[model samples]
Structures are given as structure tokens and as C-alpha cells.
Target: MQKTNELSNLTKWLDQFPLFHSGDEVDEVRQKVGHIFVPHNLNVIGQEQHLSADMNHLNLENTSVNTLKYGAGVKITCDPFEKFLLIMLPMTGVMDAEVENGRVKACNDVAALINTSDPLSMNWGEHCNQLIIRVNKSLIERTCETLLGHPIKEDVKFASALDMSKGHNIYQSVIHMLATNPFLAESAKLYPLITKQLEHLLASSLLLNQQNQYTQKLLNPEKIITPLYIKKAEEYMNEKASEAITLQDVANNVGISLKTLHNGFQKYRNDTPKNYLKNLRLELVRKDLIAAKLEKSNTTVTEIALRWGFIHLSHFSESYFNKFGEYPSATLKN
Candidate 1:
């Protein structure tokens, strides 16, 4: 008899990897599943039924893609995940999940995101099968920081539901390709570089697509290119900080209009170019003062301040005190 083809890309992908585990014993299946995911309680919900569990796990450098199913109706409970986030995409049937925020009925074209810190319980129908993507918690946070161009002051949290039923979803497409394509499997093994890049692509997709703490900042068109523009402006300012360069000069050198430069800095950095340059010069002056103190040099504060473009001693001293809580002389003195 000819074998029937599987309809889900996830099933095709799972065929490439060796079967991680498969059995009917509930305890054995639970232990094997827990080893791949997290420790959890799994029980058959129907009377006179036993588990018909099948699992295939594919581990990449920073993420894992998996497919799992229990051929009998089952209930599962898991404590809050501490180290990874799970995206559960159902390929067939339905899985109802109770997450921290609310309940989600995940099925074809609708998915559930298990946030790293949310407690979870799920009920899988006897025929339900799912493609689960497990991403390292730190990787997602780091990607958020990278996209924002700053450290995240708070733990990043994503909304628990993802609607893939509409529009082009790069994340969903990539995951689906990963599940069904044999080229990626071979490429992942043959090229470490491609593996890392693929991991980043996966993280970026979910972050940019799903609602999250950083989504507004990440998706804002005005803020999107601001980080790059601001960074270049800062670089130009730092190079010409001690020179008699104007904000217009900095803007011209950085290839942005003066007004744009000003608006970008004000909106993102909360300071104008003039103030930022002044602060930068003030820092340079303080560094010299500290160096002079350490070396016991006879260099006076006036001479060092002048070299850094600060013409007025009194004004410079006041700004220095405001920034460092001490006068320039105090910084230079024992």
C-alpha cells in the first residue's frame, strides 16, 4: 500500500528529524515531553482511554521547533515558564488554553503565545496536533533591546494571542518553511552562520508581528529610523565636540536637515543637539580634570576648560556642578 502524505508542513519537517519519542504509556510520554518542554502534569480526560503520544523535536542553536500530539483527549498544566516563550500553532483540531490573561481557542489560522511568565493550562482534543516554536527568553529580550537601541528597563511581555488569519506574516511563513523544508535542515548543520541568522529572523518576526511592550516603539515609523540618524549625529558631534562647530554643521555632516536632527534628538534623546554637545564637552573637560588630579599635573581648570570649547569659567562650573554634583575645582582638587 502507498503511504498517504501528511498535510501539515510541520509534519513534513518532523519527518526529517529522528523521532524523539512515541508511546502510549502516560507517564513515559509525560516525562519525555517534559524533557523537551517544561515539567508538567498530563492526564487523560476521557474514561477508558490511554495516551497515543507522538513527538519530534528539532533543536537549533538558540531555538527549537517541535510537533506534538496525544491521540487521546488530554489535559495539561504547567507552571509559569521562566526561561523561554512558546508559540503553539495548531495544525489540526483545536487546543483550548487558559493563560494568565484569558482563554484562547487555538486552531487553524489562530495561535496562542505562551509568554515567559504566564501560567498555562491546555486541553487538546483527541485529534489535535500542534507545531510549537520554543525561543530562548534571553534571546527575545536581547532582540527587543537591539531593536530599541537601548536596554529594556522592564521585563518584556507579549500579549498571549496571535492572529495569523490575516495579512502576510513573516514569522508564520518562516516557521512554516522551517517545518517543511529540508534545505534549512541541511543548511543549519552545514553552516553555523546561517543558523544564527535564522534564529534572529524567527525572533524578529514574532516581536515585530505580535503585540508586546516594545511593539509601539519598534513599529513607529517616526521612531524606526531615529536610532540610526541619532547615532550618526552623535558620532559627528563627538568628533567635532571640541571644535567650533554648529548644530547645522553637525546636521550637514550627518546627512540630515538641521530641523530633522533637532526633532529626532528631542523626541528620542530628550535633548537638543546644542545641549547634547554642551554635555559632551563638559564630560571631556571632567575627564581631563580627573586625569590631571591622578597625575598631579599643574594644569589649571581654566586652561583645560578652554581647550574643550567652554569659554566662561563661571557658566562651565555651574553646568559641571549640575551634572556631577560638584564644581570643576572640586573634581580637580583632593
Candidate 2:
């Protein structure tokens, strides 16, 4: 499913990872590189005249993760991501990087934690292929608040470093999902049901293990994300998804705070309430398209989309594609 007009600006094809080939165009390559991950100037190194940048990426709001390959030697420079944080590692090839205060040796045995709001730089070795996870700064910070059961007056800043050898299990879980499973496990993108689970789980893991101001609080097992509360929230959203219901509205209806609602969903569904509602709306819209097609009705894509509260046509279409791997009109074609 390709991104519809509404979602094309910020999403990839529903089932595609949005691959790109730079054809030695450094500036052009940098733009795509910058758009999905962060702004960076990529320069080919030492006799590497024919530099080609290949990349495949996805945007999970809080987790805009991707894999990039610059077919030869190159160096990348960038400022901190304004509102995001990054977790980067090499899936293949060696990288000698100095980010913030940590130095990844030539052996490339460790991952780099980057504060997108802090200045950072790195150099990529020839033949290096890397996996970069870019997550929204606010989302991670909010997760801390949920864990601690209180509002945070200060922004959460993670340590500028991580030793991958220490949290091997969590890192391995992320890698396994990226390499195989319902998320990036196969050639096609998983639907929202699975995609959200993977993203929430992996993103949560990053906040949980990576050294941060809220590490101890997040690690506490005492927080009660009552499953009953989660179900109540889910039920309310499922019933009102087509009625312009926001996360707050659902949270209120469920007798829980918005933050607690988020925590509950994260614990039980491995998803955020907003995403879970969006998923339901997407599924309903798809169903309507299929029904209209079967009945040979006069319904248009806009009608069906709007009925489901997807007023932003292009984003809705892209989101539809993101879930169904095809456009709504295609599904309803006469």
C-alpha cells in the first residue's frame, strides 16, 4: 500500500520500506537522508567517486527508524535532531564514530546514543551499512512521566552514550524484530496491528535501558497499568473511533488520565491509544471500501474516508495504503 496524498508527506508506502538510490548525488541523497532520520551532509571519501546512497525507512512517530547504506566510503555531518533522539548501530561494516562524549572504536562493536537536541557528528567507513532509530523526544519524555506516576517539570535527557554489551537482551529483541518477525521481519510492512506493537515495544526498551534521568523510575515494577483499565479504554475507543474521538475523550470516558491511558495501552496492547484508535479507523475504512465495491454502490473514497473521521484526504489515503497496501479508491473501483 502506497501512502495516500494525506500520508505521503510523512509516510512510506503501506507495504514498502520506501527505498532510495542517490546515484552519487550527495546533496539530493542528503535530503532524503535528512527527511527520514535527521539533517546530514554525506561526503564520499578517498577515490570513491561513484558514491551511491541506498536507504529504506519507516516513520513510527516516536520511532522513525531506518537502515541506510552509502555503497562506499563517506562521512556524515549533522546538528542534533531538534525534537528527536537517535539510537544508531551498524548492521554491516565498520564505523569509527565519536558522538557526544562516547567513542565507538574502529571495531564498531557498540551502538551510539544521540541526543537529537544536542550537537553531534560521525564518520562512516567504506562499505558501512547502518541501522538508525529516530524517536520523538517528547514521546520518550512522556513515557518517563507515566512510569514515575507524576508530571515531570523538566525535560528528560538520556546520557550521551550506551555500552551495547550491557543490555544485549533488549538490543537483541529490537534487532530480531527489525531482522525478522511481524514488524520488519518480512519484505512487506506489517499492518498497524503488528507495526505498533513492534515500535512501542522497541521504543519503550530504548527508554528503559538507555541511561536517562528517569531510568530508576521506569525500571520500577510497581507501576500498576491495570489490564481492566486498558480494556475499558480500548472498548470506548473501539465504539467511538468514527466519531472524532480524541485520546483525551477516550481517557475521560474510561475514568483514567490521558497519561494513564497511554500507560495502560502500552502494557496490554503494546500500543498507544492514539495509534490503536487510528488502527481501528483504518480497518473500518478498509471494510467500507470493500463493502462499497461488493455492493456496486455510489460511495466515493472521500465519502468513506470522511465517514471514518479521516478528513485529511491525502494523509488518510497514505494511512490507508500504510495499512491495506492499496488505495481506498482502488478497493472501491467499479
Candidate 3:
């Protein structure tokens, strides 16, 4: 039923006060939340005493959503949105979220990264306090292109599940954003530099970490790589080998485009940027393994290798043997 009494402050309404109305009120809520997100159709699933939402913008580029709702449940649906990528991270309760064919069981540690072009729906549990982020779509796409050194042929897609487990840079970035709750809670606005830096950081982290259509090429550039872009890309890589980075990131940091970067690596190094970076990390890891062994310490291959993004232990071992003429373990012992 349409209730005209709902507060117009949907983005800032705290649920603590005795206020929430009906379907129409919730619709108005959706409209107010638009400053930070796209409008969505919300259906209240059960009778509830309090259903409230509050949002704070880091800037036009990012918005943080704080919501508390109680009832049997609620569903929020959206078709393709012209802007913003929706990322929902539950802090108190679980939310069942789906985007196209991918489903995410969102909890305190897991989040749902949604691409707005795909139809999305979320079912929130009776008691849920969730934090949501609406990231600017154009900013992300542009960053992706800069990293790729080329235009994207398909929509930028993100893996449905955002695992907050250790080593996932995206998860760490999200946590860093949340840690800035003081600024969000202090005022409805933020300094341009503060917010813009945060938005750019999130965009960069996701493009580098999230598994998407461009992941393989970004991670392991091949067949097309050449020498023109090689020296610059290699210098960039050598400068930041310890950090989590992709070929696209290197391409972006270097003043070259992805195609030109590929040409440079091929022409000079006769190797793909990805391959060179991988070997560099492997060599670094071997050096550490040997030093650890010499010290008679507790260092192990698995622990040392994972730190360098080497997940496939067998493959790493094989490559280590090929490059050094001995297994990693042997290298460590010697």
C-alpha cells in the first residue's frame, strides 16, 4: 500500500527510530538511494516492524550502504544499470544473491560482485545488516582498458563469489574501505582527494585480482607480445614484483598500449611479459628458499611459493627444475 508518511531521507534513514512504512515507502527508499546506486524494485517478503537503510557516498564514484531489516525476508531486483557495479558484503546476516547464472552466498567474509548489465536479485535473511558498495562503472572500464592497453570487446565481468580469504587483494581492499567507516559516519561528504583515491584503489584492485574474461591474457600474455613495449613493461614489473599485479597493470603503468607493449616484449625479450614476470618471481623464491635452508630455519616450499602467487606447486616445481637443473627442494638443501 502507498503510504505518504515515509521520510524522504532514505539514504540516511537509520532503522533505530520507529519509522518504516509499506511497499510505496520502500519504493521511495529505492529512489533516494539513487545518489549512490541504481534504482531497484524491492518486494517485502514478510511483515516486519523495522526495515531501514542508510547510505554514505565516498563521492560520486563510490557509495557505502548500511542497512538493517527484520522480517521473513525481502527481495531486491534490477535489470542492467547504466552505471555502477554493485558489491554487497554482509556484516551480520547472510544474503542469497544471483547474477545471471552465478549465485553468491554472501556473509561477513564473502561478498557478491555484481555487474549491472546482468539481471540481479538478492534475498536477505530476516535479520540482516549488510554493507554495500556501488562503484562507478565507467571508471572501472577505463582502468581496465588502460591496463589491457586495448579496448574491451565484451562487458567487464567479475567472478560472482568474492572470497575474503587471505591473499585475495580484492578482499583486502574491501576491508580497507570498511576501515574508513569513521569518515563515512562523520559527515555525508568527503574530501575530493580522499574519495577519488579510494575509488581508484578499488577499481585497480578488482581489475588486477578478479577472475574475468580477460584474466588469462592479462595474467599470461602470449602469441601477440613483442619488444617495443618490453623494456618499459619489464622495468615496471621489476619495480613492483612483490605486489599483486597483472600484464594489464604493467601495460597501464608503462606509457604503452597493450598491443604495443606486446610487440616490445616479443621483439626484444622474445618472451611474453607474463612469462618474464613469472620467471622473475620464481627466481626470487628460489633465492629465499636457499637462504632459509642455509639458516637452518623452518621455511618450506609451499609457504614461500604461495607468497609469490605460485598456486600450482607441481608446475612451479617442474619449472624450477627446468630453470635450475634441480628440484626446488634440492636447491634449498644445497
Candidate 4:
């Protein structure tokens, strides 16, 4: 009953958005949805009934959120999703899927993460309505590389089942925010900074939270003894924190490979070098914001953030909130 009510509420919440696709015709609905996602074999099953399908989609730069329902039982099969990863959360009824990991019946508490290049199939219950998050393949790979401080040769493979009961509600919250937030509605047009950060957030969240090929390595990055050169690298980073520097630049200055620099930071600082530099810049931004607040200065957050090498305001604001438990504007105000 509780799950049903929650799904009902979510359905209502999603209905506020204009429909992106809907129809009672099988071929038309299938083709429309295929264009939005990918071409797939969508077949009606069990009954010879007129099709009833509807979809609501929101597209971002590197990620998209979609709510889909085929008001009749349907079986869908497709080749590997070669370009993106799909996270499927069934809002009502069951969705049985066969992916690389194995077969799983996704329902209220169970979600699906599909990323492998293996052919897969799914059977959606007649009343099934699902919320799907599509993230770009290259985005995930790039985020993984940033975390490992090196390029990955193989694709990131995620376990098919996502146990949403175990604190995975963050995805829904983010989706809800995207759907309802007025600023976000116009973010892509007027707030590229926000979209960039949101892109990073989604990519990072998937890599950090989902069970993937790099899970163990990411959790326990090889703990080597911190070397003197690692300390020197930190010093170099501190001195150059205000400059637009890349991981390669830091490694080059320390006369070490990116992998070696990552190992040192992981072992000694319990973080990736990329994050270390970000936190350093965030601290500088906060300090400056606090001073501005005290002096009643008219300097904008954008100016201070850009001065400290943060190009994306939304990303900077999100990072500021994560670090200080408040937005940069709040810091500037109070």
C-alpha cells in the first residue's frame, strides 16, 4: 500500500511535465520512443489489444530523465546500448529483465542498471510505469578515469540489480529537483554552469554508488606508502591552486606519472588528486566569500569562483554545499 501510494504520488508529480510521446498505436509509439532512446524491438504480449503508451522526457547535456508506460503487457529486446547507460526504476508493477549480470525482476525496491554491451531483453507488466535515467557512456568513462587518475581500457560494467532500499533514493530526489525546480527548467538555456555540474554529479554518483568493475579498486585504491615526492606534489598543488591546472600538470611538476600521484593521495589523503585540488579551490572560494560577506562587498560569487578557477557556477555551488553544508550564496549572505 505504501509503495503504491508513493508511486501514485510520483506519477502525479511527473504528469505535470508535458508529454514527450504517447499513442494508442503500436508502431508509432514504438518508433517515437526508439528515437528518444534507441531503436529496439517493442512487441505487445499476451493479448491482442490496442496499445496504450506514454512517455515524459527531460534532456540535459550528458544525462536525461524519462518516465515511460506501456499500459499493456509488452516484451522488448534490443542489442547492446553502445553509447549510454540506462538506470530503470519501476514505479508501478514488475519489469523482468535479462542483462549481462543475470535475470532480475525489477519492482518497487529493486531497480535496474544496464550498461554492458551484451544483448538484453525485458518484459514489462501491463500497468508498468518506470522512471529511467540515461547517462552518456563517455561521461561515465571520463569520471572513472578522473577517479583512477588514468585512462581505462575496458568499459565500466554495472551489476544489473540496484537495491534502492539501501539509500539509493538520492536519484529520485535529484530527478524531482530537476522536474520541479524553475531555475533548472531554464538551466540549459541560461545556466550552462549548472548543467555542467549536474552532468558531473550524475556521472560521479553512478560511479561512486553503483556496483561496477572498478568498485573494489575505487573503494580501496592501492594503499602505498606516501613518498616525499607526494608531499612535494601537494605543495605544488597548493601553490598553483588558483591557476587552471590539470592532473597531468601536477604530475609533471612532481616528476611522477598520474597513476603514482593518485596512489599517493589515495594512501595518504584518502582522496583522489582531482578532488584534492577541487577542495583546495573550494576552500579558497569560501574564504573569499566570507571576507566579502563581512565587508559588505558587492563582488559576486561568480567573480570569486572564477578567480579560483571554477568555471561552472552550479558545480561550484553544489560542491560548496557538500563541503560547507551551505551554498556559496548563503555563505556570502550570512
Best by TM-score: 1
In the order shown, the candidates' Cα RMSDs to the true structure are 13.9, 10.3, 18.3, 9.3
Model 1 agreement with the true structure over 145-238: per-residue lDDT tens digits: 6777654556668888877564687886677666666676678767857877878888898889888878888998344445687999899889
TM of each candidate vs. truth = 0.64, 0.57, 0.54, 0.64
Cα-lDDT of candidate 4: 0.77
lDDT of 2 by residue, 89-185 (tens): 6656667666665665432346677775666667777766666677666556555655665445555667765455434557546644553333443
Instruction: For residues 1-334, write the lDDT of model 4, one tens digit per residue.
Output: 1253375464555555546545788778878888877789988987746457878876775677678888889999988987788888787878999987789889887878888485789999887888787877767876887786555668899878877663544555554455345455466767756886877776776677778889888877775566788789879989999888899999999899999988877767657889888878887997899799779989999999999998888888888775554578887884
Task: Estimate candidate 2's alpha-carbon lDDT, on a 0 to 1 scale.
Answer: 0.65
Candidate 1 wrong stretches, greater than 4 Å: 1-10, 19-21, 221-334
Query: Of models 1 and 3, which has the larger lDDT?
Result: 1
**Candidate 1 lowest-lDDT run of ten:** 1-10
Ten contiguous residues minimizing lDDT sum, candidate 2: 1-10
Q: Which of 3 and 4 is ahead in lDDT?
A: 4
TM for candidate 3 is 0.54
- lDDT per model, in order? 0.79, 0.65, 0.65, 0.77
